[model samples]
Target chain A: MSLDYLTALIAAVLFAAAPLILAALGETISERAGVINLSLDGTVLFAAMVAFAAARATDNPWLGLAAGGLAGAGIAAVLGVFGLLLGASELAVGFVLTLFCRELAYFMGHGQARQPGPDLGALNLPFLSDLPLFGPAIFRQSPVVLLSLVAVGLVWFFLMRTRAGLVVRAVGEAPAAAVARGLAVTRTQFLCCLAGGALGGLAGGLYSLSVKPGWGHPQGCEGAGWIALAIVIFGGWKPVRVALGALFFAAIQVAGIALQDVLPGLSGTLFQIAPFPVMILTLLVVNLRRSAAFREAARRVPLLGRLVPRTAGGAPGAIVGALDKGF
Target chain B: MTGRTSSLARAGFSLALALCVTLAIVAAAGAPPLTTLAVMLDGGLGSGQAVLRTLSALVPLLLCGAALCVTFAANLWNIGVEGQITLGAVCCVWFLRDLGLAGLVPPFLAVPGALAASMVGGAAWALLSGVLRTHGRVHEIFSGLGLNFVAMGVSLWLILGPWKRPGMASMSGTEPLPAALWLPALGGRPMSLWGLILAVAAFVLVAWVLNRTFFGLTLSAVRQNAMAAERLGLRPKRRMLAAMALGGALAGLAGGVLVAGLYHRLIPSISGNYGYTAIMAVLLASGSLRFLPLACLFFAVLTVGSIQLPLALSLDSSLAGVVQGVLVLTLFAARRLWPAGNTGSTGGTRNRGSAA
Candidate 1:
């Protein structure tokens, strides 16, 4: 491919990755706080529709983004109240809400289907746009794309550097210990879930107002939430890694489209279906490090024996640790 | 509050809450809430035809619900029932074409053969997820979700590719199966009497297996404590796989019924969210086999009735899904608030199984 063609592909990948990054990061935060918000797919769909409708009505993209974020937080609040406050099963509530929100979106958004709405366009930075390959690929993008990048850095710094970040990790890792240390476990979790939800809503806005643009029946965002959930696991709940996971997923999607010309017989349907299996495989590999049998098998291999670590690491302690309880 | 009384009160309150919320939504949409609901009821059950349509919808819901009961009792979330149904339909269509039995074989023989193919297809698809859970340490929920996507892709490929119509492929679907292969309809009703009979038989079989068999006891034991079950000489993994296979087979039968009896064509939307809606029905049943039929009918009404919403209120029929979703959420909340004395821990364990 020509340099220009490659750069354009890279840029397209970035734009596509934006929503995934936002949603996955939000999930990372929520899961790290010892809560799994499985309603992400529905939340994103509802938010996208709401965002599009809001933008169409107000003629303001920023308002649409805010509306999307609020919608997400509102849905997440349902999880917070029921799962966290009422001590209901988070998974069951989330699963129900996911289906509910999806249907609700379809019902309310029927009128908005296929209607044109305000969308974010590329904004070239004065200095950065002048740079060669990186400029066009990274700098010459919509504000949402830039914000998504900044979000990666911000989430990382918040989780790794801030005191509140410590509290978040502490609650996720050892809620009882955090409780004993005087941290209000429930409050922290509730706040984290809300924050995570807001991000998810913004991700939805990114989809309707920028990435995919326009709403239609079935909306085409059905699997994005589940992919984001898988990405959180694939990234080991780390912000930077989660961002990379999003980029990697987006790259696969872009590459699939790009390869259609080179390999006509491969079929677009095959390409479309590729990510789910790939994500499932990645999930297995990530979890394998913790499985004793996998570790034993790795030790028997000549090269892998030397490289494989004796101890598994990186999973958010509370989220995966709860698995041991079989709950 | 006494447990039973509290539970009753909570149920009443939640129902009211759901009604209010739904009405508020209807009003916001500029539709008369009471009239809209009346139309929905009329559409779902007003005439004999409407009742028949609802009964037809109940076939898949009941089958899928019964299927889920098998796996859920064993504490496996076979979320891929949606995908399994698709595969079943695909298999049914393929059987009809490849067997070349449209005219050669008798209707009874061809139909049974096609149904068997669907069961095998669904079982095989579900077994893949079961294997992943047992061996690969992957959660069935995620694996099932992934497999669902793969199943959709496969069906799409079949419709748009090799199975495409003679002239050109379209989203409409593959050509209809020959008339001889179609299931016999019931007295000019939209649904087949055979499909209803099959669903009833499946439900009875599931109830019997769960309540009367040693296998059912083993499944419960495994669900409660795999380690304990292992020590007691019961193979938890094997039981799990069996439960999943049984579940998949039933769901596949639902798919087969949809194709042979209802749609008679393998369209992409054939499943119609039946697999997912069945999850809600199963959950609402709360492990009671007797309640399964009622739960299925209730949801069937919501879905079948919602079809009138777009016509009467200018609303999307998907509002039915919204109601179902809210109902499940409300049930979860009520379960927490009331704490049913005997079933409390079962609810707790189910939560943990999915959460982890």
Candidate 2:
């Protein structure tokens, strides 16, 4: 394809990847703080439905976005209460909430399905829009894409450069130690989960108001949440890598669409279904480096041995520690 | 608060809380709460036909719940049960179509053969995730969720591509199987008695295996501490794999029943969220096999009754889902509030002794 076509494809990838990046980043935060929110898939769907309906009703996308974020925070609060305070299994609670929210969204948003709603249109930056290859691809996008970009940097900075970030990391790494150090583990985790939920909510709003631009039962965003969860793992619970994982997933989706013409039989169905398996495979590979058998097998092949890392580690200490706790 | 009395009290409180929450939602939706409840009850069990419909729905729920309980007992999250069910149905259909065995073999043989194929298909699908967990180090939840999507894609491809009906491919699904391949209906009802019978048998077998056998003790031991179980000569991985396979087989059998008994054909939505709903049923049972049938029946009533919401109150059928969700959440809340006599073990707690 021509450079212009390629740029447009890249732009499409960015637009699509924005939601995943946002949701995954949110999950990264929650999980980093030792709270797992499996309700993301349902939360996104519910937020999407709510945002779309609110926007259509009020004729204001901003209000709709706020509503979506609030809904997300609300759901996260429930998770926090049960998981952090009550000491329930966050995974189980989140899973049930996911199903519940999904069903509720369908039930409540039935009337709003296929209805017209405001969409955030493209906002091209003057100087940047005129730049060579990156102009149209990066600068001439909706505010949501820009927001997602800002979020990546902000999240990275917040986690790496701030005292609060240190505490969050410490809490996730070792809740008992954090507690001993006078940090309120439960309160910090609860707040982190809520913040993550808000981001996830915003992601849902972006999905409806920008990316897909409509509400439909079993909307196009169904499995996107699970992919976000996997992306968080794929990114190794880091912000920058998480963003990359989201972009990579989006690229796969765009490439799948692009390949529809060249590979007629396999492109549509197979391509659409490709991300899940590919994510699972990526997870397996990322994790396999830690396995002794894999290391032994790698040792037999000189090239593989050279390529393999000496150690596969970097899971948050608290997460690894909590694994023994059965969560 | 001790023993059975406290447990009963907790359950009662959770049910009441769930009811209040659901009623509040109904009110918010502009429907009269009492009227809606009455309508749902009538729709689910007012007549013989309604009860039959509820019972038919119960067959799959019970089977899936029983299946889930096995995996849960072993501390394995078989979230891919939905996908397994779909694959099972797909395999059953494939066996009937490609092998031409439906016509070649006797009715009795063909029916059992198709079901066996379904079980194999489901088990194999689940085993993929099991291997991933044991060897690949990937969590079962993520792998299972991913596999669920892949299974859906496969079913869609079969329906819209290879197995597309004559003329035009549609979402209506493939043509019905031959009469000889179909399971016989119960007492002139649309559903098959065989499905119900099979589900009950499976439940009884699982309950016995889980509660009364040495295998049950070992399985629990493995769940409680895989490392310790390994030290004690039990292969944790093998037990886990067996548990997953058995769960898959049960769920697959549910799917087989759906095809051979109810739908009479393999459709994309054949699984119909039964696998997911079973999770709620199993959770509601809270480690007690005796409550499994009751939980399944309760959910079946809500599901079958939800059909009336659209017809009577102009509400979506998904209202049932809202109720189910509220119920589970409240149940969890109640368990937390009254931990004294709660016998229902959250999956995380039974194995690792974590606070969760």
| Residue A142 local lDDT, model 1 | 79
Model 1, residue B185: displacement in angstroms?
1.1
**The 10-residue segment with the lowest total lDDT in model 1 chain B:** B347-356
Please give the lDDT score for candidate 2.
0.85
RMSD of 1: 2.4
**Candidate 2 pairs with clashing backbones:** none
* lDDT tens digits, residue span B72-158, model 1: 878888889999999899998888777745455566688888899899988999999999888888888889999999999999888
Report lDDT (CA) for all predictions. 0.85, 0.85
- Alpha-carbon deviation at A277 in model 1, angstroms: 1.6
Which segments of candidate 1 are over 4 A away from where they belong? A265-267, A306-311, A321-327, B1-6, B100-107, B340-345, B349-356
